[model samples]
Target: MDLELQTERLTLTPCTDETLLTYSTNGYKLGPHIGMYLEELKKDASALGWGVWLVIDKQTNNIIGDIGFKGKPDNEKSVEVGYGIISTKQNKGYATEALKCIIEWAFNSDSVNKITAECLVDNIPSVKVLQKLNMTKIKNDNHMLYWQLNK
Candidate 1:
């Protein structure tokens, strides 16, 4: 599915092969980690339906980052979400708005019972984002914090 999610200040477009290639090859402002995500999309069939998405600044009309599910929901009807914003776009609450939009979309599906996320424990901003979304701190390890929001 070609999914495009819009928030108050951003537009999130699903990362298709053509778009990913263009962003990776050209001097687009996306992060380098996107290449790995592109490879994962290529290898996973589920990614075609619910994978990487490009985050755009609606006001500037520039791609600021990306957010998406790791894959389709599991047998447990749960799925994991991940996101990133370029350094220039951080601290604007754009990530939070985009996440709220995506979470709403995911939960709207009957197949989804819960949404999950993991972030570096030391990344206070990301931790705050997860907390702002009301996702419970389900677990944590030496380096990462795991969060979940049940529908």
Candidate 2:
């Protein structure tokens, strides 16, 4: 995957097996969930753009966090997005900026017509990010708030 999304202050790099291995070798700790995503990619090469994208801070040239979809778009052409920023990077607009870039990229694809996201009810910052993206609140269940934005 040669795809890279650039923002004013961030660079979004889609993760591949080689990139993940390189990052790990350089001491970037990937969580277990990320490992699962890697396994998914290994099983299906087409999962590239649909999996994790590392969030790199432009100034520092360091991975500050990650943001991406859980998988490819479904039959309805809808995909779910998820994101995280390091505690030190939280409260900054990085999540919003990165997500905005990725959303545009996804919507530009003919395979994707809608983007969905979910966050814990108590996650105020996540709620604000979704609201800023103009994703409508669609459901609330099991303490999770589901949101969707149609292209």
Candidate 3:
């Protein structure tokens, strides 16, 4: 949404091309993960008022990471929630905190029915983050683990 959402320490807003470019640079240091599709994130913001946003610390306002839903998934009416916390900020519970906000928003939106996500099976931290959100594991393929939050 054009609005801002807050967690105890983070804020979420719609992702834009400006933010996407910023995300690419910030995300690289966080993980080797391929990164978000700029065009797709724009599509989400335009069509749904929801897309990945720069995660800013409430106290520091530092762009520590990003978290939000993308518009592509095999499932209809479903969006995939994705996140990346800077490696420097990793293990501080930021990923889990960011994820909790995104997941709750998805479940509450009429535009989105189910929220799904995937992680490299070897990404132990990500797996735990999803579990903490109560997202159930639904499949594993090609070394990727898939989970869904259906409300």
Best by lDDT: 2
Off by over 4 Å in 1: 20-33, 36-46
Greater-TM-score candidate between 2 and 3: 2
Q: Residue-wise lDDT of candidate 1 within 40-83, one digit each (tens)?
A: 77787566546778877777677777888888889999999999
lDDT (0-100) at residue 61 of candidate 2?
Answer: 74
TM-score of 3: 0.78
Candidate closer to the true structure by TM-score (higher is better), 1 or 3: 1
Give one clash count per candidate, in the order shown. Answer: 0, 0, 1
Give candidate 1's whole-model lDDT. Answer: 0.81
lDDT of each: 0.81, 0.88, 0.72
Q: How close is candidate 2 to the true structure, as a TM-score?
A: 0.92
Report the Cα lDDT for residue 37, model 3: 44
Instruction: Write the residue-wise lDDT of candidate 3 on 29-129 in tens digits.
Output: 43322244455544444543455566777776667887776654334668888888888889999989888887777666666678889999999999999
Candidates ranked by lDDT: 2, 1, 3
Top candidate (TM-score)? 2
